[model samples]
Target chain A: MYAELTRRSAWHDVLPTVLGYIGIGVAFGIVSRAAGLSILVTLATSTFVYAGSAQFVLVTMLVEHSPLLSIVLSVFLVNARMMLMSTTLSTYFKQEPLWKNILLGTFLTDESFALGMNKLNYTDRKLNFTWFNTVNLASYLTWIVGTALGAMLGSLITDPTKFGFGFAVTAMFIGLLYLQIISDKTISLKLQLTIILFVLILTYFGMAFIPGNLLILVVTLLGCALGVILKHAHN
Target chain B: MPTIKFIFWTIFCTGLATWLTRITPFVLLKKFTLPPAVIEFLNFVPITIMAALWFQQIFIQQSGQLPAIDYLNLCASLPTVISAVISKNLLVIVVVGIISAAFFNIVL
Candidate 1:
């Protein structure tokens, strides 16, 4: 159904990101392994879970034995934003078969989506399933290699604190948030700050009294509410 | 701690749910468009949840006492947040955070 992709052309667009992908992929693998996941499991997670921040969230939730539904739901909700990417790409992929479009969607990620959109808008190169899928495949291979290397190294480094990994998940979240802020540009910094401040205070004060699980829901709702309220007020 | 079976299932299910989020929208985009308010809310989720997760990490919960601050994490977070503002890159933020954490732990 798809044309044969030129690796040279695809790699041209994907070259800059290969190092970044391998670096972060290594971190994810090491953190998951040091958290007590087996090498096989870590590899499975990198292969299937796919999303970076989502995998970090999974490591924490799974280790805590959080309710199964909650884990799936949280990941679903966090990643649901990717739907916007799929929607955008669907426009570009409409010429292809439904199965091929879905297959492309399965491999879509924040980086690849941005890359695809960037190519479509600015460049003369034809953006097609073949090119996009090749980009994804190259990145995926490097990511898997990085993960395997880290998993092997992780066996020697159990307690990550001494190596400064005690707050890796939290740091990852901050990075994720900041990255979103720059990319979307629709939401004002003022609104983001207001919601963040509210969540920070709410979580801190509620921690002494509220259960962690319940607190997560309450904060998420109120934070989202604050965002919507502030946004509408401006409009 | 969960059983190996439970972990596998969680991974498998999460993978499916995540993939579905990305895949179904391609098929559904023509038939449905999320309302502006819902889109706004969905956009805020990553922000709100990230803030919550960051808080959970930096604060240590005590049974009777109010939450205690994780000094090491707190120290590292300052630079990480700054890097977030200045760099706005995930890898940069993470690397800065890791370095700050390691530096402080060694000195203090």
Candidate 2:
């Protein structure tokens, strides 16, 4: 069943994420410091809150004097997609022990979940705990450390975009999407490309009307549904 | 600095909310049994999610009218795609993309 799963070492699957998290983590730290968050608070946020965008929103909304309830709502809305991801991830992790699933769930971020799914899904990668935890713990620890470094380096490294750090996450996504399509022989190249085009069009059209978080859910549901329908028809 | 109580509260609430969204589904759904079709559908989620995230980053939305393309990102994507196709390596594509960003940033 897992013949194609262990093609590469765990480090190979995780290095890009580890590197990108460090860079983004630094940026997050710098932003928190600039927003007047103390180093302890910054560490606590990254350690406890963990979700990158939500942490950024928490910092911004706090600065903007949004009420605590509103901040919680905003954070919830921003991270609602994680609910979908966590559900999808459960398809794989459901068999694990309760504590393991909970621990894995705690560490599941957008990057780890997406990367794991890309391989574990269309391709047959056996995502063992050893491998999965390596990706999660390494990325998590580095993110915390990187935020600490960025908080300390605050003024020295202003304007992270100057070094092109801004594009690292996007670049990683692009690369992963490319790999996801290219490696999967389960579906035809034509259908994979068609699905990509279909999802892009849906996202593009929905951008102006729908909110980012909700729009993603809508597009993902519609796009993947159509993809499955087309695949069945193709068969 | 913001007041200590405020910081602690925000951190506690935001962290809790984020954790729930992230952890609840696994805890909640693991108990139930899903049908096969739904499982098949979940397989398709990753690609669409990836595409959505890529789109949001690639194009910057203007409050009104069509969204404008970030030309720098567009230009950098060419090399990144090429590296993805050629090397099939994450490190290679990301490095290519970052380098492309630096190069385009200087020129554009």
Candidate 3:
């Protein structure tokens, strides 16, 4: 049964996820090291937090010697999307054992969530915690390994910023967006446009007065609300 | 304040904040099933969130200046988009983006 599920997963879908984790994981490690964090801290965050955007936000704030409030707020803002991710998984995996659901929910990063949803659609099977665990095992391992490598060699590798290492995360998002676009053109376009506008407005506000993290929260909530309206109107 | 105090506060706040946010959905959803309307809305959440993130990374200004166009980023991103469209290969897209970004950075 396990082998069959692995075989059923489109390697094409899994490949982007793995590449994304590696690239983004390395970026986080480099930034963490540059922030003066020990390798242990770097690995701990990557392993425990397991959320790329949040890790980056936390490390960046720590580097600036921002107050504890800022670090907490930044991570919360970046990871607010997890609320949505876990909600969807809950509905899909509703019948699964409670313990398993909680375990899988903790591992629900962006790529894993996307992959899990896609797998569910392709297989037309109920996604239990077991399937989630299998897919997430690969993701978690890659992320930890990539982050550790980056932490160890980050200082040696000069000019990470100059190399556009930062864009690795963006590129991964774009690639994932492209996949969404191809999968469902109409809805994805609308969602993409709305988010672009929201970001532009939020960034403007963030630059003007509000903190960056607060701006992110405001924009994301607004976007989520708008998306709900659009979905309802369409239906 | 001492550095140790700062670290302690950072860890405390970070840990608390992380735990609260992580637990919110699980706790809420366990008791109640989300309505279909909510579920449908959530479908679009990831796409929008990611778009916002990508936009900030690609377009946001670094220095304290008006949004000056980074022609290099634009040039690099344009080709990256093309490569993504043509090849649809993650590795190829990454290579193209990196090379283009590097080339433009050197030239400009």
Question: Top model by DockQ, which number?
Answer: 2
Residues B10-35 of candidate 1 have per-residue lDDT tens digits of 98999999888889977775456667
Q: Candidate 1, residue A105: CA error in Å? A: 5.0
| lDDT ranking from best candidate downward | 2, 1, 3
Best by lDDT: 2
In the range A1-235, model 1's lDDT, one tens digit per residue, is: 1123466667876664565466567777888887788999999998988876678888888888799999988787667657655765676676678787888888887667655644543344247877888888887887888788878888775554676755554566676666555554557878888888999998888888875545665677788888988888989
Q: Which ten residues in a row have the lowest lDDT in candidate 2 chain A?
A: A1-10
Which segments of model 1 are wrong by more than 4 Å? A1-38, A51-143, A165-185, A206-218, B1-14, B43-46, B61-66, B84-92
DockQ, every prediction? 0.46, 0.71, 0.43
Colliding residue pairs in candidate 1: none
What lDDT is obtained when candidate 2 is compared to the true structure? 0.80
User: Model 1: how far is A211 from its true place, Å?
Assistant: 5.9
Interface RMSD per candidate: 5.4, 1.5, 3.5
User: If scored against the real structure, what TM-score would every candidate get?
Assistant: 0.63, 0.93, 0.79
Q: Ten consecutive residues with minimal summed lDDT in candidate 1 chain A?
A: A117-126
- Tens digit per residue, CA lDDT, model 3, A60-169: 77767787776887787777767767776777766766677767766667777766654553455356555677667777888999898889889887556466554555
